[model samples]
Target: MLQDHLLEEHAGPAAETEPALVLANAQVVTAADSFRGAVTLQAGKIAEVTDGGAIPSGAIDCQGELLLPGLVDLHTDHCERHAVPRPGVQWDPLEAAIAHDAQVAAAGITTVFDSLVVGLRDADQTRRDLLGQIMAAVEKGETLGLFRSQHFLHLRCEVTDPTLLDQVEPHMDHPLLRLVSIMEHTVGQRQFPDAEKYREILIKLFHVPPEQVDERFRRDAEASRTFAPTYRAAICRMAHARGIPVAAHDDETLEHVEEAAHLGMALSEFPTTLVAAEAARECGMATIMGAPNVVKGGSQTGNVSAVALVKAGLLDILASDYVPVSMLSATLRLTGDDIGLTLPQAVKMASLAPAKAAGLDDRGEIAVGKRADLLRVRLVEGHPVVRTVYAAGDRVA
Candidate 1:
């Protein structure tokens, strides 16, 4: 049985008086169109959208800013950093959750999945110890209405860990658990095709000695070979049985994409090569790339360029990854002349596409009857800055 105390099924704010809202003189970006329009919100849903310069009486003047659907981030590592802000410092669990929530809300993410590692192979004891604590914190915060954005859980299972299955089972029935992704970040495979680069990255990330890197990599690789295949299958079965969406992480080959499709994965997260992404699309799996990758112009690890994939029409969704602000930033960047995506198309990737992929059908668009999660954004010096945010018809930021 799932832990009842640790899970709450979409416990949103209780019934209350929610005032109607209206923002006129804005560029309303929807799932299929972008038009100069006004959006009206009533009872926590979009009541109406009027096209072209029709400013209703008592409506807030948006002053020709972009009124976009608030972003839906399928994956973000932002919260974990707050859980342990520094190498040895650990903040209060609930405090960490609220702090992360504030940042994500300000970044225009109305819905976010907090990515938590189910298992870790390295010597990051702090992270390993804080996983359950953070999960509990998210639940507690949601129940208490402490979060500004809707939060869900995305368990990133590190298949190389022998204890991965054990660690994952407890959260299988968590109400907030919406996504599970099987990952094998062992070295010289998947995300780390270049072993030396992987070593350097891990050295900096874990602050380990150079001399100890090779031995650790060898052990990790051996462990992955021993446990990954079996654990991957088991984790997928568990997630699928529970009706949770499972994603494939860092797929780097056609074979990898094929296996993920065979396992019935719904998303290919950060496929490391163009071939892999193309294969994922062919296999009918939606491809998700890091928003930071687009913002930074390329993958930090020298994988396939997200811009290249977008130009090729192979990318379907954008995840904030480690940067909460990158969701809107990347969405706007995709609309530039170089990328060539229209404003509506770019907004859909960050909002509607991810929401639909994660089984969130009620929000993610500025259409009538959808949840009123909207962002008022203005471009100042070519940077998209969010001025106001509304989630469920309530002003959150």
Candidate 2:
């Protein structure tokens, strides 16, 4: 298991009596620049950052590894995938949460916003039943400090479902409900403009029965036509009332971007085309692309490429979406020759940018007074590897 593998590494240097933990001899990547430096942590926050090759006494030697701010993922469907590992297999909620946390922390993520799907009436009943159970378990795990990473909620609401408003109303005010995204996967629109591709996704990717694809597609299309407007409006209003930021998912058209902007969405999740991404920029909305898209060089659903968005200057944040390890991999890939972004610039898209988008200002950079959430990473055979992880100045993974 991944948890056992990560647990086998050494935690760090022995305990110090000076009330501060220093990581020296690191290639630190800050929000503004990268340098060979040392960082000090005290009282669960970053106390100081020093530029040089100096190694303070009693400091943990980083051995020239990369020191990056812990990643903040605004959208990740990882927990849901863990909760339902296969078509008919459902793991226990608390156990799934623990497994997901371990994977996320091992991937260099310290703050994770677990995306939970809601208001899918035609989907698997097992998945629908696990939503509340997963949320409750995550909340309990966070409260008891039973996990390595700090978990929050990102509710992905399907506006085509007429009961969407009711399904999300109770969670709107939940303290951990940090983000809400409105999306409708109607055939021949937005993400699934091609009916053939949509059919393939339903049967191959989502594991929907081939015999039931047409019926489900028709039902979803009809529901989208009838209920999308009202349900989308209601969900947005409810989220706005409590000051939670809303995101628009898989926007493909100029009008869709405009409507989402009018609804006061903070970000656009996975804009499916260049025009939509540009429109989002015009509307003062940040664009979030999936990390897997960057790693794989294209979207799994055959939409826009994340590298294209970077070249066009339209990408703002990077979400792991379904693959947690892709976060750090995508960050490093962006600094490659094809994309041509500096290490610091690439790291910000996964860390500071997402943190700011989610209204979290305290723990995204290697600066004084910020939460000491950091990652010790190294390159193994040219692939970035997470060596150790710390959250709020404590070594967690």
Candidate 3:
């Protein structure tokens, strides 16, 4: 059962009253088309999408900006950044949740899945210790209508953790739990096949001595390899039994893609190579890449380029990953002449495609009867700045 006391302690405000909104003088990008139009919001849903005209008479002028559907982020670690703002510092769970929501909202993410880790990598079990409190705060805050954007849980299950099942067992029935992904970030595999680079990255993250890096890597790798395959299979089965879609993380090769498809994985999160992404797409899995990778030009891990995949028409969706603002910027980048995606097509990857991948049908587009979540955006010095954000007819930022 959930800890209601934790929720009560974290609960904040209630939902605000929504005003009927009319977004006018913008290029409305829908799944089907981009046109000079206006979109009307009433009762928390899009009431009308008018092409080449103003909406009624009280429409708010958008100054010829780009109007896009609210972005749906299937995976994000930005919340975790709030939880542990820095090394040895843990912010209050409720405070962290609220702060994270505000940041993402300002970045035009109207719907986000807070991808919390299910296992801890530290000796003190920092993540395990904070997981319950943070997750409770998220659920309670959203339920109490404290969040501007809708929030749900996306458990990033660590397949190498021997206690993975035990850690995950409690959250199997969590109503807030919407998606799960099996991950094996053990280094020298999947996302990191370069041992030296992995060591350097680990040193920075843990602030550990160079002397301890090699020994720790060898030991951890052995342990992870011994446990990963068994735990991955079990995690997939449990997630499937609960009717939750499971995603494969950091796929690097065709074999990895094939194995994920064989396990009935619904989404491929961050395929590390073009071959893997293409294979996943051919296998009926949606290929998701980090929006930051696209916006920043390439992966920090030196993996495959997202733009390369997009150019090949192999990329299906773009996740905000660590930077919520990257979703919009990456989508916009894909519309450039080199990328060749139209405004509407690129917006679909950030909004509609991600929502569909995560089994969300009520939101993610500007169609009639859909949730009135939209972004009023403009390019200032070639950077996409969110002028305003509306979630369910309520202007929050």
Cα lDDT of model 3 by residue, 1-397, tens digit: 2434322322212233545678888899899898889998887788888887564577899878888899999999999999999988899999999999999999999989999988665547665779888888998797677999888899998877778889898887787787999888876788988988888888998787889888778767886879877888888888899888999999988888888899889999999888898899899999899999998899999999999999898999999999888898899999999889988889999899989987878778989978888999989998999999998777889
Residue 215, model 2: lDDT of 92
lDDT (Cα, tens digit) per residue for candidate 2, span 116-178: 999977666566767889989988787667889888899999988777777777777666788
Which has the higher lDDT value, candidate number 2 or candidate number 3?
2
What TM-score would candidate 2 get against the native? 0.94
Model 1 residue 120 lDDT score: 81
Higher-TM-score candidate of 1 and 3:
1
True lDDT of residue 127, candidate 1: 67
What's the TM for model 3?
0.93
| Stretches of model 2 off by over 4 angstroms after superposition | 1-18, 124-126
